[model samples]
Target: MVSGSGVFVFDSSGKDYIDAVSALFCATLGFHNERLIEAATRQMRELPVYPTALNRTVPVVHALADALSAAAPIPDAHVLFATTGSEAIETLIKTTWYINKQRNPKRHKIITRRGSYHGSTIFATRLGGIESIINSFDLTGDDILYAAQPRWPRDALAGETEEDYAHRLALELAELIDHTGAENIAAFLCEPVSIAGGMYPAPKGYFEAIRNVLSMRDIPLYFDEIVTGFGRTGKMWGSQTVNQT
Candidate 1:
């Protein structure tokens, strides 16, 4: 449990424990921020609950969106609010399908790396492609395709450099797209730095190589910044850290 004053947690014995996970990595401002409290108080005094849908734009909502977009690297970044990361993933999946449908109706498949975790929701979990989760829930579906994860500890062969591993993975993606017919593929979605898929700092030339392969067939490279965004990797955006932008 987190106290509003930066005090973290208390055991049954009444001893405090420092928050290690830091509220699912979301509390960048830390616990018990007075600013947050003041904002909440002010908003509660005005309008406590408001739905963003149905063409409603509350002042706080607009301010928050503007702040988020200002921080976003894209020139005209769009913001969509959701209760959880799972919801965000769901939104992403829908947005991907929507964008692809607008561009090419045939493109419907989403290529994600094995062992990656977007969220626990059905669509995100299906995109995750973990064997244990897939076996337990039968999540492997036709719409989501899996690619080999660049797990250096398990994947690198004897005498292979990290660059070589990255190249091989990119090549594998290309081969899969070729076999699957690139025209039918919608996007290659991956975390800029593989986090729960094992916190792998991207190998050198990884993003560029993969981008090159995906770009050849007009496939979109959807960087899952849920983990690596907001200076977690010491940059404003992970794409900026990896020079993907």
Candidate 2:
């Protein structure tokens, strides 16, 4: 029903509208970009296709991997490329499971927030906290857990300051960890800015407090930046925007 150019989509009758959604938040550079077209054309001309698995990689893939790894927040962090956000999320979940299985097989549970939308994949859907999506699918699992979203406006108590709200949320997370048993948790996953969930940024100090709790318990923290990455938040990364590290 829609066709178009950068930031503007035209209907069949030629009525154009701004594509504010940006193709599910992936096309941050907009559509029909000549630079992207040229890049793709050049790459196709050089190497049309190559498998990335089993150490088979093209020059462009290596270059991109190097760039992303260099830009990663963690020191000496490696990069794993996936075709989609959902695949990347699945990779994260599997990676966490692998690590926890080595340490303590029972510590495979992942903690996410209510209203979060991870993906449509079976395991990913189970990890997502959106009720409607989960209800639509028979994603039965007990390894994923949900926590309250850090939405200050909706969840904050009367007259509570932002800092207090953040602390309260942190306490709630601590309590959840306690109830669930830190030993049973592999990682805590969330978005720096919850866009699809509710379009709300975490209150100041919210991530910091969460990080403190997770660190104390030695639980890894994973940031789903598929929607918030690449300057959507006016920063190179959402973690930077939210002062997560």
Candidate 3:
């Protein structure tokens, strides 16, 4: 209701439905904001076919980069634009493997959670921890290790506290790392909150504990902020809300 645009209808039927998911939850700004519509119109009118690989530049791209940089925690966090979240994830996963290969070829595996969802691409689907995704494609990616998901509501024992549950999850992750031999793992990737895995928020101290383990093992933590970015979790970033450093 922030911008308040009425839902679209294709026929004369008066029945209308709420867009509960908001176009795969990407339309956080809601439908048809004047600014967004105007921006798209302007971009389409201007030079728009420049590909980044061709080293071509566009004013809108530069402007977006500047704005993102101004709001980013890292002043120089380079932004790689993609048409969708899946493409962005694909870029990151491949980039991670390439960079690790350059530094240490043995460190090729990426660790993720058992119930997480990255994207629908073959590699990303394999990287994700959802059983249905893996089972549907007969994916047996040995490089990625699936750690136990930190589901406080479901995984926590009857008498267990949130802090205790987080610690247990951390311990289990540490054990997995030890079993997998951290030297062979390039990075551990996850969203700050489990979104596609049912929107379950992480238990308290989960990120800090996991971060410490990754730090000790020299594994880079990739916070997939595609869903939780732009203050969706009542903060600028979910990592900041969870105190992940």
Candidate 4:
């Protein structure tokens, strides 16, 4: 592709194609947006890049964090920024592990669904459900567990209702937790919508049932909203849309 406008991209041969997937699912603002371009130009001129460390950060970084905290769905949200989506997800994984260890030293495992893509980092890639990516890595960790993705249509019974399917899936999670020992488990990480499995949202009441199961052992649920964030699921976050919040 040579140039783009709105959601359309033009190739070298002058063929136009719709950037329906938002350019690998992150470029939602489209291409050559005047406002974005202007902001970029201005920021580059003012402060191109700064390493936020040793208790020091640029004003724009702090401003963005404040804005995101106010805009986030989670109550009293705190923001942590990363250079890329993969790095962001990796940060989340590390943060959860750190907190979990502080809470309980044995609580080190993280449960995620099958057919979900978390990130490309070694640890994040292990948490992801894609077999191809996981296999590509020579490094392996046993703390991550895989549960079935909550796509009711693909895994539901012939006559099962959404509620029933959700409950069943939650039951499976509970069983997995029991087998693994709840005391040894950390948080359950999830993609609000499946990325590896074609962007399917969880079934109705899926989060509710999962929450019920997690509540028994005080397990926290964390959503990786890289895909279904920014009103992609008709809400600011997919967690709100799927009742995960």
The residue-by-residue lDDT of candidate 2 on 21-83, one tens digit each, is: 888888888888899999999998998998888868888999999998888777888898888
Top of the candidates by TM-score: 4
Off by over 4 Å in 1: 2-8
The local distance difference test score of model 2 is: 0.87
Error of 4 at 133 (Å): 2.5
Instruction: Score every model by TM-score.
Output: 0.92, 0.94, 0.90, 0.94
TM-score winner between candidates 1 and 4: 4
Q: On residues 165-239, what C-alpha lDDT tens digit does candidate 1 reach at each position?
A: 889989999999999999899888988888888887778888899999999889989888887787777898888
What number of backbone clashes does candidate 3 have, counting pairs of residues 3 or more apart or in separate chains? 0
Model 4 steric clash pairs: none
Runs of candidate 2 exceeding 4 Å displacement: none
- Mind sharing the TM-score for model 3? 0.90
Q: Number of clashing residue pairs in every model?
A: 1, 0, 0, 0
Candidate 1, 41: how far from true, in Å? 2.0
Instruction: Give Cα distance to truth, residue 235, candidate 4, Å.
Output: 1.3
Shift of residue 61 alpha carbon in model 3, Å = 0.6
